[model samples]
Target: MKQFNQFAARPSAMSRALRKAFVYMTLAGTPALLSTAAYAQAVANDESTSATGVGAGDAALPTVTVNAAGESGQHLQTQSANGALGSRSVLDTPFSITSVTADDLADKQILKLGDVFSNDASVSDNSGGYSAWASYITIRGLPADWQNSFRIDGKPFLGYGITLPYDHFERIDLLKGSSGFMYGFGTPGGLVNYISKKPTDTPVRSVSVGYTSGNIWSEHVDLGGRFGNDQMFGYRLNATHDQGETFNEGYLRRNSVSLALDARLTRDLTWDFQSIWQNSNSDDQTPSIYTANYTGATLPSVISGGNRTLVGPGQHLNTNFQLYQTGLTYRINPDWKANLSYSHSSARRNRNEQTIYLKNAAGDYDNYRSDYLEAHTYDQWQAMVEGNARTGFLEHQLVFGASWQKQVNDYTVNSIYQLSGTGNIYAQNTNAYYSNTALRTYHAGEITQQALFASDTLKFSERWSVLAGLRYNQFEQNAFGIGGNRTSTYSKNATTPTVALMFKPEPNTTVYTSYVESLEQGGTPSLGQDNYGQQLKPLTSKQYEVGAKTSQQGWSATAALFRIERAAEYTLGNALVQDGQSIYQGLELGGAYRPAPQWQLGASLMLLDATYKKGSTFTGNRVAGAPKNMATAQIAYLVPQVAGLKLMADAKYTGNTMLRAANDIELSSYTLFNLGASYTTRLGKYDTTFRAAVNNLLDKRYWQYQYENYIKPGDPRTFSVSAKLDF
Candidate 1:
């Protein structure tokens, strides 16, 4: 057999035999499925619903819709008889919004947050085996953090993190492109809004349990019901638990759990309350970046291994984040509504290391302390009222609203230090005297944005309409003085105007063009420079995009072209230091194609040319970790009905790109494949499924996923078999 990769293992005889059988069976079902597709042409406009076991006439199903994120918030589609409640989903607009329905998730046996990204070719996650909490997403080949915003049921949250769980959400809406206008402060990297399940007007009782390979287990239950003839009172409760272990020893064992509740007190008043607590602990077997092990593979270690960089015996990372939220909505009337919501998240993370590495010229690689500990408790509250109606000069509609959002990060630990790589080293820390206390440190100021906004959608004619929006914002930041309370505050007034023309000649197609801008605070100050505070300023960026979208029957697709420009950016800083200022720009082309009711294909390509024109910020140097050319594509096909047997196969490939623009240091491109299948049957009244999935089927090896490499590697091939029971 031809060699595949450092981590690659030859396919077993059983696996090969199964693949052959599946190929033949799937080929046999192709025609039947094709015929089904023809019948679906009549309802193709609503076809994205195919996987959910619902037809255009499935009026018996309950209402499950989200109006909080993406353009989808502008289009409402659900299984309810009275029509979808709340806002319209992005799928109906010119913008791109891909929504994964609950039924589709169940059919695919998706068990975690990471699994969902498989459906979106425009996204990437690099924190494979080291830490599930280290998950990062990229769009249009932009630095994963370029400019992306995140929302949960219309509520906005900032910072970097991973998905909590899939069990609590009814669906996930991926709103591609700049979402800053509605999400408040955020990156340019589109947006992801997790719509949690809410209270229903009818009672429902369901529970499920899933067990996967790698010592994985999951249990979830949801109960909801209504009281009174008018059903003025309703409540819903949800809970889930997950725990698992991986194939690698160092990169093992993780879990999360949470609960949510919703109550409707009256026709005009309602409340949503939720609480979640989760903990993730692992050895962080960080893989290698520029280098690899005895095997010629350059890919980072799939798991943190090697006795040399022990990071200390029993070294591990511990992370815990908890959240609480409450919201009140008043219908006020049929055409108008108002809402007030407050969300809070407290996170505590710590890394204990006992690793040995080459730290100095003495050819000595010893135990060293590299700390990026974080402890933050942030909160955001917003209140807004909006109304919609039809009138003259417009046959369409209108929506106008205003609100305030406030977020504050507390006890921010932004510091760096050096320490022993091993516990058995001669450089044992003098806990007796606490030497080497001279490590550098600095504190960051609070970032705040207060704004006033308004928007209007005018239907000038049947084929054209104008979306006009304006926002006035006052931004301020204070960088706290190190070792002292001295602080410097920087403030600015900014205005953003948005105008777009949407053309829709048919019910399932829309094409639109729009422009948006975003601003973010800069980095650390200069070391030994007691007050490097006043010199740092906020970085501002502008982006222009034009995209067209079409969705019908069970098929949805979108094509977009985008350009992003960054005028001010910070560079090279160490322990509270100021290093460089630069300008960045890039062009993007992307699309998602789901041609079949049971299969889909998609990809995105981002070409970038960025530089620091003046003053040697990176001075003629390409930025690190900012790859020049990057694109990923995948195809998924499902096996047709074979009694209780089903099959699925997919492949994803990433192109080579720069880890840093400077020196052209490149992180070569790579690709991976995935295959899965499940068997379903009914044991009495209970429904059950047995599934097995193998990721990175080829197990190719390569360097780290980012310019920082930071001693973290990508994930290796792993196989998991699971079973789920629903009753």
Candidate 2:
């Protein structure tokens, strides 16, 4: 037997105790997770921009907006989906996509990405306590993995974990249904496209400082200006800093930098260059080992048995996400434009995890190598030439685009054994295990994606409008990983047909119904030839939604009911289990009403029913972590006569959900409330605002989502106050 301490005899008592701790941690975490800060904001200026200066104190407030269409379409004139896309409305293309505009974000006080996604019932955060720092966002109960991609200002911002800073985003766009036709490689449920804040031709500068509970502090500065002698060039810059402690002893600090530049090449040609630098320190997971209640009865909030300690022992974690992207759009004629863009990112993560103390009750004395660190780089470039023509014969739109993307990742780690109780002198130099070489070696993959799509809008009569479209895509990826280098190329072809009929009973009300088809490549016979290679087949889905949107008297409300079905859903298992299948059916409602010029009320609510067919382990049972209902509502009032006085209160609710395979183990429903008020004034050119707010007002004790083996309660009631100043 190997002796840990050469000078002393091996103590039997210490050995037994350490063994117990290891089993406890591995068995499943108990109810000992840290707190989830109630929630975790914007750039760009047009006449539409509203800057909420930052402030410092103990108040929690989010710079928020709650719009359905999102920031991209806010400046556009058309309200309906087809008109916004011009003549690009095709049979298989998606026209029902939704965006949360920056203007709407300005009024709503939502901070965290969870707050933004709350609008779609299909979207849910399953952070579960284990990795409270990172929420496993599931859409229609589908995991966000290779199929889902995230971009900042249309540029890829991939990282090892899902921790993000919402303050830097202008708005979030949630495209419903399969989008492989346009978005390439994502889940059938949808994709989240984040638009960055762009520079404005108009000049404006402001700064805000604020704080939250647990002594959290943050500051933000936004600047915009016109460039050049002619002022054709414009620039926008935004910067933010945040520091705070979470549920336990862990801390969170994040800062991000974003800049946008625009240049008018000519009367019709425009070029924009965007860049972002973001760095954050976050925990990947902090879950407790829990034993489910066998009887299905209510269990205690605190676990009677399990490990209780701070996460990561005494290690520090740091991650950096940086990106550079430039896009060029040229108008060839009055009705046509050419779009070209390319982006690249250098994403690196460093983590340290282990036992830190002997007397401390927060950690295990294990020397196991659990800490993970890696670097991933992806370069993607795309170009598309599109045109819109309106003639006597017909009004049509055409688009031709081709894209190439490459990704490479390198993983490194060290494994060693150490003493259980002693805090120091555990392990020394030993063989290091580099994950990059052991598992998926550092490899590069090249993917070529090409597509051509066209559509036409036929206005046979004033009372009736019909639109149609078709698109084709060719995709290929050549991959090389740690197992060795392998090239897998395959060809896939798909055609999508769409039909839409809209009847405008009145000038302000429009009701429309449509169905669209989306296709995805599933297998590559070239790669699957070997055990490590995968011969992918195609996966597809169908989306059907009927919605009615009406804008009248400064109020807009839209509601849609949709049913989406996919042939198969990958389950949790060794081989990416594809046996199980499911259908996600849900309803989405969003609206904003200006009861008075100063008072605005907007709400987004979605109720869904996700059912999975018979499969290996999940046959007939509700999928784990799938919540049945989710909702959000916000009301904000700005005193028109009072310059910059605002009061806002928001409420959100997530219904009960199952936690494990038995369906007997589950987490009850919970509701949270948020309230805040802001008073703003101008001092010369400097703008300042004082704000106050409360999070988890009710202090309800509930379980956010947890596995059958463990239980962790939600956060308690907390209060905060803050102030922001801008110049």
Local distance difference test, each candidate:
0.51, 0.53
lDDT of 2 by residue, 1-727 (tens): 0121231243245333433432343221111111111210111121123333332221222333322222112121232222113322222223445566653443333444455554445566544321323534666555444323466654555633545555556766666665554555555666667777777656767655554554445666778888776788888888877655544434566788888888987788889988888887744224333333233345434321112242323344577878889888888877777778888887776654433222212222232333455577768777766676656855555555566666554544232223323221122212222222232224444445555555555554444566565556566656555565575555566665555666656656667776767765452221111332353455676777787766566666667787877655432322333455567777877776666666777676778777666566666676656678887777776644333456677787787777654465667777777776655543324444455666566666566653323344454455554444455
10 residues in a row with least lDDT, candidate 2: 32-41
Clashes (backbone N, CA, C under 3 Å), per candidate, total 57, 63
- RMSD for each of the candidates: 10.4, 12.5
Per TM-score, the best of the predicted structures is: 1
Q: How would you encode candidate 1's per-residue C-alpha lDDT over 396-438 as one tens digit per residue?
A: 3344444454444433235444543323222322211122234
